[model samples]
Target: MDFERSLDLLWRDKGETPQPTRGRKPKLTLDKVIATAVALADAEGQATGSMSQIAKELGVGTMTLYTYVPGKAELLDLMVDSVLAERDLPGPGDPLPDGWREQVRLYADRTLTVFRRHPWIQGMSMVRPVLGPGLMAGQEYLIATVSDIGLAPRKAAAAANGIEVYVQANAALTAETAQVEQQTGQSTDAWWGQRSVFWEKYFDVDRHPAMTRMWESGGYDVDTCEAVDEAFVFGLERMLDGIEALVS
Candidate 1:
């Protein structure tokens, strides 16, 4: 598909049209279907889980699941929303005690934690905005926190979206890393180590100066959350600095 069509599937803002329920009446409620799907994802990874697998786990036929969720896509949306519900939020007017940067740090950490626990959630979430309450509340909290830094509602919403994108992108990369490890029975380090010789043989130092510098800087260390956090801090400061300059 084209970029816009792919983005449409990712953001899914066209409105919440429930898939027409079909097939034999399921003994399962929507909640059961969602919950089972979530459980299956938790255990097997999102890509590994399928409608048939989920139905078998719930002791229902695949057709029975179709009655509740329009298809695997809808089921994924429900699973994401359900996972979001597990996240805790700061209370109203609790005062994001440490200021905007700290508030954002905590927010990103919490989001990352959730994605780590539910790795499949990263895959499911990027598919659409289901207007699910949990996702809405999380966004609302981010906007409110940004407003404390004196951003107007529109600006705050935009900033919150940017932060959300960062968190999701990081989690997606990490999840892919895990999947690679699972499939190859090798750590990312080992895989890269095996490829380093090939890269060294073909990659010219003069032709890709910047990439050579980055590669020489010891690339892709998994035990570098601190480095990642520092980059996140740097990016956030840049964002806020740009906003401050604009507002000033």
Candidate 2:
């Protein structure tokens, strides 16, 4: 989609409900189309989420959806911005809360929340980012928060990007793990147990002494292992520590 068209759609007022037209009343509004598409993506995933699927979910013809959204690519851009609009980030003028580390931690946590809420978003290509208003606002908030601290502009921007990458990568893994558990109807421990049996049968422990030792030490046991939240916190702190060292 062209930049102008994307900007128009993303910046369109989603608050005002669609009004009845002169001839035939509109069956689907832009907000409805976006919401329905989000629901479809959440349920069926991005790969299976198609124009026809969204149209079927909304009980409208495929061509009808085209009037509201040009195509799946444009629709996806809308969906991304729509999801980002849900973020509860502090405004640029808002003061940094407590220590810089704490503020950065909060930022990471909030970003993770968005990813957890929309797992399918992780699948979308962020390489060529769609700089919609919602996403731009989020970036502004992150950079502002970091810059509000002692970090210089360049460092602050880099730090914010680092935090984002960490949160997104981990959130994607966590979401995938949850999806697997849900589909298989098995907890992580149970799934690991099944895999362990296969490893015990055919795997040669002699070849990988360190891995074997770690497995024997209960490092691989899901029941006793650190929770995802704990791991995230630990990793986040370490990442912050590195950034702090740089600042010092």
Judging by TM-score against the true structure, name the best candidate.
2
Predicted structure 2: lDDT: 0.74
Go through the candidates in order and give the C-alpha RMSD of each one to the true structure: 6.2, 3.4
lDDT of 1 by residue, 30-53 (tens): 777777777777676655688899
Estimated TM-score for each candidate: 0.71, 0.82
Cα-based lDDT for every prediction = 0.68, 0.74
Q: The CA-based lDDT of model 1 is what?
A: 0.68
- CA displacement after TM-score superposition, residue 139 of candidate 1 (Å): 1.0
* lDDT of candidate 2 over 1-248, digit per residue (tens): 65666666787765653342233456868889889888877775443587888888999878788777667888889998888777767776676667777777776777677766776777776667777876877778767667765788888889888887787678777666655665567877787777876796888889989999998997766562256777888899998888878777
lDDT of 2 at 146: 71
Worst 10 residues of 2 by lDDT: 16-25
User: Model 2: runs farther than 4 Å from truth?
Assistant: 13-25, 94-96, 182-188, 221-227
Q: How many angstroms is residue 224 displaced in model 1 relative to the true structure, after the best TM-score fit?
A: 7.0
